[model samples]
Target chain A: MTAMSSAGHSRERHALLLMLSVLAVLAILHIQQGARPIPATVMLDAVLSPDRDAFDHFVILSLRLPRASACIVGGAAFGAAGFLLQVAMRNRLAEPHVLGLNAGASLAVVLVTTYQPVVLPDILMPFAASLGAAGLFGLVLALSALGSGRFDPVRMVFFGIALSALASALVSAILILNEDTLEQLRFWLVGDAAGGGAAAVWSILPAVALGLVAGCLLMPQLATFSLGESISVALGASVHRTRIAALVVTALLCGSAVSLVGPIGFVGLMAPALWPRLHQRPSLGAFLLVAGSGAAILLAADILALGLLAPTELPTGALTGLAGAPVFIWLVARRLT
Target chain B: MTSRSADPPTRSRLTAEALSVGHGGQAVVQDIELDIFEGCMTALLGPNGSGKSTLLAGFARLLPALGGSVRLDGSDLATFPTRHVARVLGLLPQQPPVPEGLSVFDLVARGRFPHQGFFSQWSRQDEAAVGEALALAALADLADRPVETLSGGQRQRAWIAMVLAQETPLLLLDEPTTFLDAAHQVAILDLLRDLVRRHRRTVVCVLHDLNMALQYADRLVFLKEGRIRHVLTHPSQCDGRIIEEVFEMPVVSLKHPQSGLPVFLPCASRQPEARP
Candidate 1:
């Protein structure tokens, strides 16, 4: 048994190493793409040493690096959030986008950005988004809990879809009316990484860190949740406390991701869903792998967004949604069959 | 009460005091007082809607008391930290949903949840406990196999091993032998009996089979209509009257030819409707 477990441990380490290496390569590729493509060596030099006079170095330092960082960080946040939500709800399709969290954040950002007369600081966007995500999630919980007095996964999923549609309609109505905000919010609405540059990344970083920390802390208890409610409780896990903590952590992550890059979809769904292929089941190490896989997928999407149309950048969100929809269908088909 | 003449002195590990348990404010088991003795397998026997499972759930702290308290070691069971209680009392509910692709060892190792911390790594002690539990449940050879692929008996044993891995002194099982073959039922019952006698674990389990309960249990608790009807310390003390009243069926009490254990055979009732 010990030998077998040690072998499994080594296999996990190898998988982790491969995942990190792929992510590193993706990050490099992400930073390398632009109108004027810079060589990898020049990018490396620009990062390691100070050469502020060079335009390429400045662009690498200012533009590409931060954009890549935002994509990675935001994607990771979404992945962790999705993993938590899926575990909590015991549904594979439970992600920020499906659960109305992203839409809620988008609505809040739009309301705060376009509706207000005063110019709000960029840092407040994540806070506004967090509030919206948490509020909408709470509403979803209450709505689902209405008939059953418990959070039924199916009911919660349906409620989330319905609420997300309503929230999306509200956002479209506000955007269509305010044409001035439309042009400014258009790229963000489609989940672009261009606006996130550095300041946006910095603003959401603390929240993401805090969320990841809380997720790590709650994972041991959360793992037992798969044993079903009764067994989890019998194992001495405080099911209620663990569940609430999972939700709060998810809100923090989804809110941060939404604020960083307008509500990107599918990373959360795909990352955790694809996790078992990398590892046999959910574990603490699998948590990090899920987060890393999320980062890699989003970064790859962003890279495709930058280079797909060659000077004409596409929306990262569109690409992710386009890629994610089929995967989502496959998941549903597999589950139903 | 009738066979107190040969009863051995025993300590009570769990004591329910005026305990009332309910669902959604409607009490199913009300104002119940019961004592679960240490190092004994006490089978809870009652008909459907008699709150047998509810009483078991209450003792496991899975349900909150409506009015009174359940005392564990002379302290209110509700007062102890849930994890603390878990380390002392393990429960195996009927139909524990096993996740797909979960190996038997992995499933059993999860029983160490209460003993683990956030940063404290899985230690040799945890591994040893899991191994001992697997060995005890006779699942060591199938440790690497997924629980879903196991036979009904092996799967049930895996679940039992998980609770055993908790190392709890008190175990509450709800119908551990349900849906198993006759041989498997006897195997599970014998295992529970051995757990009480050999390991000195206190057990309170709800059982549907009257003969099985009578054969294995050191004590029998009969509940009916949200109340405990009788507590029989010896199999000889279980008369047909209590069984008939609790189950609402006419039964004939007979002695087993080989073991001389009491057995109740239920009299047939109305037949099923004619099928097309």
Candidate 2:
């Protein structure tokens, strides 16, 4: 047993290192391989000391840097959130997009941007996003609860899909009512990472940090949650409290991600799903690996979005959604078989 | 009522007062007044729908009582925080949903969750308890095997190993041997006997088999229609009549040849001499 466990431990270490290395390489590609490609020396110099006159420096600072960083950080947050949602709900299919968290954040942004006469500042988007995500999550919980506090996986999945459709309808209704903001809402709704430069991301940093802290706090609880509710409670876990805390962390992360690049799909689902292939158990280590791999996937997707179309950018969310749906379908198919 | 009874000289009791345990607002088992003595093996036996599992769940605080309270070692069960309650009592529900690809060792180690803080490092105590539990369950040989891959008997043992890893004084099991074959059932019952007799751990489990309970349990709580018919210290205290009443079947009570303990054997419901 000792020998076998030691072997598994070493395998996990190797996988972790490989994941981190991939993340680093993807991040570099994201920063250096945009349509206006900046040389490494120029990018480094711009990062270390700003030369306001240099065009490459301007592009690096004002465009690609934050976009790349947003891909990494927001992707990591989404990965953590998705992992928590899957464990808390005890359903492998559960993710922020499937659970309507991303849609909720988007709807909140739509509501704020369209309904309010005064344009909401970019700084407050994360707050509205978090509020929307948490509210939708509460509704999802209530809908699935069905008079019982128990989170039945099958019921929750149905509720998530229904809730997402309802949110989309509301978003469409607002867009129709206010036709003037149509073009701007289309970019945000499609989930663009281009203009999410430093100031915009920085404004949401507090929310991201808050979400990360929540994820860390909930990791231990979530790790034990796979033991099933009875066993979890037997091990002295307050099942309901652990559940609420997990949902809160997930909402915060999803909200933060939405605030950064609108709702990019599948980064959450694809990231953690990779760990099981590496034989990762549901633990803090697995959560970190999922977060790293999540960052990698989104960054790779962002690179494709930028480099693929040159001057005309593909929305990051569109790229992820197009690819994510197939993988999600495959996962469901495999599980059913 | 305060006496701890014949329980390895240790003092820990799970006592219930007019406990009405149920799901939603409906009580499945009502007015369950009982005391589970420390370090003893108590088996709850009853017919289907008699509420053995529900009563155990209520005692574990998974199901709220409609009216009345359960006290854990003199502390109101409701007042004890989740982790605090976990530090003392461990429960194993029937056929719990197992995570896919979880190894036996990892599953057992998770039993230490209650003792672990939100940020607690994996401690030597936790590691040792897991090792000890694996050894006790005889699953040390199959520690690396995923629980889903294990056979029915091995899987049952793996679940027991997890409960053992909790290292609590009291364990509550809901039909621990319900689905196992006859041989496997005896094996699990023997394991529970070892738990109580050797480790000084208290066990309260629901069992459908009367013979298995007779052989293993220190005491039996025979329930019928949501109420206990008898709490017997010895099998001799029960006769064929009580078995017939509870199970709704006729049986013959005879002495075990070796131990001289009473053993109930099923017999024809009608007197054999009657014409066909």
Candidate 3:
């Protein structure tokens, strides 16, 4: 028994080391591989001791540094969020956006900024998104209770899909009615981290921190819940508590990214899919690995986005989608079969 | 929240008075009274859809009673907080889902959740409890094997091992030997009988085999059409007619040559001499 536990411990440690190294390399590459093509030595100088007058220093410090961190922070949170959502819902294919949280947040923001009288700053958008996600989640909860008082997995996912479709249609209608800010809205819709960079990353930091802390705390409980509701209840665990914790952590992670960059899709799905491949069994360590690899995946995607289309930077979401689509499709296929 | 600590525990050890159970606000069973004995094994037997599982669910407080209430040690079972009930009684479902890629030892260890806090470390006592449960279930050798890789009977025993690790005084099991072959069925029933005889733990299980229940359980409650038909205190006290009425199938009782326990056989006639 001691031998097996130690082996499991070593496996987790190996995953941790691997993900940290991968994140480090990708972060440096993310800063260096931009359109400006700063050399490795200059990138090191920009990171270590920035000379204020150097154009390279100004470019590295001002542009790529924040952009890289935002991707890492956002990706890590989403990775952890997706795994938690899957555990809560008891569905292997469940994703962070599977519950239509991003759709609710987007639609709420669009409606508030376009129709309402409140002139809010971009940073305050996450609060609106939080409200929207919470409201929609409540609606889902209430609707699921219509037939049975218990929360049914199929019913929850069904309502989420239907509501997401409805929200998307409403958003499209509002977008058509107000084409005046079409250019700005188009850029926001595609999801990029270039414009706000460092400021946006700092805003998202608390959400990421909240998600990481909460995810770590709630992870063990979530594993116990997969045994089914009766066993979980018999074990003295309140299934409702696990569900709420999952919702709160998911909301923090999803709201942080959607409000900042509109929505970065598929990092959550891919990170979880990739984590178990690195570790033999699912544990807290595997969860941490997923979060770390999520950051790595995003940073790598963002670097490609910046360098792929030279002067005109591509949207980070599009690049992740391009890489994530085949992988997501493959994962879904594996699960279905 | 837990009950007021000042109040003493209930008097009737796990009693249900005027119990009615329902799913989705629809009552399935109504007006049932039962007293579960401590330090004994009780078996619930009924035909398919006779509400055997439903009654167990009510006793476990998994379903709300349409009327009446369940009490443990004089305290209302529903009134006690979830963890408080769990500390005393543990229920193992018919086919509990084994987590993906988890080993038997780890799965059994998960049963110790009630005794643990979110911040509590895995203590030596927890280890001892898990080790003992695995040993009891005859699964100590397969402790390292992933649960999904185990055979149906072994997996069922593994689940029982997990519930044993919970270390609850009262255990309610829903069909512990459903899918096993006849040999394994006897093996599990023997194991459970050993539990009652040696450990003196209170066990309430829903079983399909009449002879098995007659041989193993100390008492049997027969239910038909969502109500208890009769309670048999001993195997010899059971009437063949009552079994026929509950199951809608004629049966005959035969004496086991060695143990002299009643063994039930399904046939057209209830006469003992209808053939072998």
Task: List the global CA lDDT of all models.
Answer: 0.87, 0.82, 0.79
Q: How much does each candidate deviate from the true structure in C-alpha RMSD?
A: 2.9, 3.4, 5.2
After superposition, candidate 3 runs with Cα above 4 Å error: A119-123, A136-162, A172-181, A277-283, B1-12, B268-276
Across A33-136, the per-residue lDDT of candidate 1 in tens digits comes to 99888999999899899498999999998999999999999999998889988887777877789888998999988888787855767766677788899888
Residue A289 alpha-carbon offset, candidate 1, angstroms? 0.6
Task: Give the RMSD in angstroms, all C-alphas superposed, for model 3.
Answer: 5.2
Error in Å for residue A5 of model 3: 3.4
| Alpha-carbon deviation at B10 in model 1, angstroms | 2.3
Residue-by-residue lDDT tens digits, candidate 1, B1-276: 122224473788899999999887788998899889888889999988899999888898888998799999999999999999999999999888866878898889889998998777588888899999999999999998988899999999999999999999999999999999999999998888788777889889999999989888888999999998899888779888888788888898889886688899977666867879
Please write out the lDDT profile of model 3 over residues B76-146, one tens digit for every residue. 89899888888899899877876667788878888888887767746778888899889999999999898
Q: Name the best candidate (by DockQ).
A: 1
Per-residue lDDT tens digits for candidate 2, residues A1-337, read: 4565566667778888999999888877788986665778887899899999989988888888888888888888888888878778777788889878988998887888777756677777887887898898788878898787767766877898899899989988889888976766777677887655788778887887787777767777776678777888888877778788888888888898887888788888888777763222566667778888888888988888887888777888888888889888888898889
Docking class of 1: medium
Q: Judging by DockQ, tell me the better candidate of 1 and 3.
A: 1
Please give the fraction of native interface contacts (Cα pairs under 8 Å between A and B) kept by each candidate: 0.73, 0.71, 0.69
* Candidate 3, residue A177: lDDT: 87
